[model samples]
Target: MASIAVYSVKGGVGKTTLAVNLAWCAATISRRETLLWDLDPANGSGFLLGVEAKKKRAAQSVFTADEAPEKLIRKTAFDNLSLLPADESIRTLGRQLGSIGKKKRLAKLTETLAKDYDRIIFDCPPVLNELSAQVMRAADLVIVPLPPSPLSARAFETVVEEVKGSGRKHPPILPVLSMLDMRRTLHKQAREANPKWPAIPLASAIEQCAVTQQPVGAIAPRSAGARAFAQLWTAIERKLAAKK
Candidate 1:
């Protein structure tokens, strides 16, 4: 199975949105047995996907104590898409992980679920703390959603440096531009200036996720945003397949 983390140091860069939509595409469109694991305490992925995730058992339970992966994983409304929900208790996960050596905790937990999933996408917390380090260690590919701004670029650099610093045989870092409005001059210029930027346009349909509570592709498959997400999933699949 391929483990992917949708992560960003800066919050509100559309990381959760990318995680939800991409996992949906991977499961529904690509037919992969995908699991979207919410590691963020905020529960943004759960909210966006319309999964309340109010269960007493959570992802942190698997790490804080000992719990089987199947015991914690909850099936979502979509076929082939399951969720390992996050409870508010996750706020203390960093502390718990610290006690167990952050680098290996997440990797070890994920190793248990590898046989059950073809793709596991972590909707990670927005910090470079112990928890983030653990996510990096566990992930096969890290997708960083970057807004088109100078600070975002700098943050992107930091993410690259962090993965490189890990010195793992395989470091997962895939950067994608998110929430881009082509109508805005800055967004247009940023795209033009950086010809190689994998910029996913900010489409009206994507923004409608707040009201629709569904994946962009499911809400409006022919929309521009849906197409962009589909293309992004294709890129991700190719990258993972090439590794195998």
Candidate 2:
């Protein structure tokens, strides 16, 4: 299975939204058996999917060799899609993972789930810690969402440096421009500076997903937000294909 992580060192960059919508596209559009794993302690991904942030066991269970991740998997309303929700216990995940003393434990966990899933997407926390390091080690592709700002650009540089410092073969990073407000001069300038970067426009339709508790593709398939996510997923597929 292809393990894709929607992550950024900086928060509030639409990382959870991208992860939820992309997993929806993978399950509904591409018809892949997809697992959306929420690694953030806040559990925004499960909330977006209308699933509560409750897990079957303690946070440590996820990294423990004796525990089976399947037991924690919760089926979503959509077919071919499942969610591994996060809980309050995960607030201490960085410590939990550090105590395991295994850098590649998360990668090994994904390997065990590969037989059951065609694609695994992680909605990761916005932190550079042991947990983040573990996710980077496991992911085949790391999708970094950046808002239109110089700080975002600098954050991307930091992400690149972190991957380089991992001391292992790292996954390819795809920088996506999220929440792009075309009317703003700064946003326009940012887009022009990185024309090749795929962008998700800041629109009411995209924000409506929070109220509707569904993906844009499911709620407003013809909308620009949905089209952007669809196109993004297509690009992701092409990148994964080329990697193989």
RMSD of each: 1.6, 1.3
Give the alpha carbon lDDT tens digit for every residue of 15-113 in model 1: 988999999999999898999999988888788878876466366778865666677677888999998888788888887888876458778778878
Best by lDDT: 2
lDDT: worst 10-residue window of model 2:
52-61
After TM-score superposition, the amount by which residue 99's alpha carbon in candidate 1 deviates from its true location, in angstroms, is 1.7
Which regions of candidate 2 fall more than 4 Å away from where they truly are? 53-57
lDDT of 2 by residue, 128-218 (tens): 8898888989999999999999899999999998777776688999999999999999999999999999999998999998998899999
lDDT comparing candidate 2 with the true structure: 0.90
Clashing pairs in 1: none
The TM-score that candidate 1 achieves is 0.94
> Candidate 2, residue 28: CA error in Å?
0.8
lDDT of 2 at 231: 96
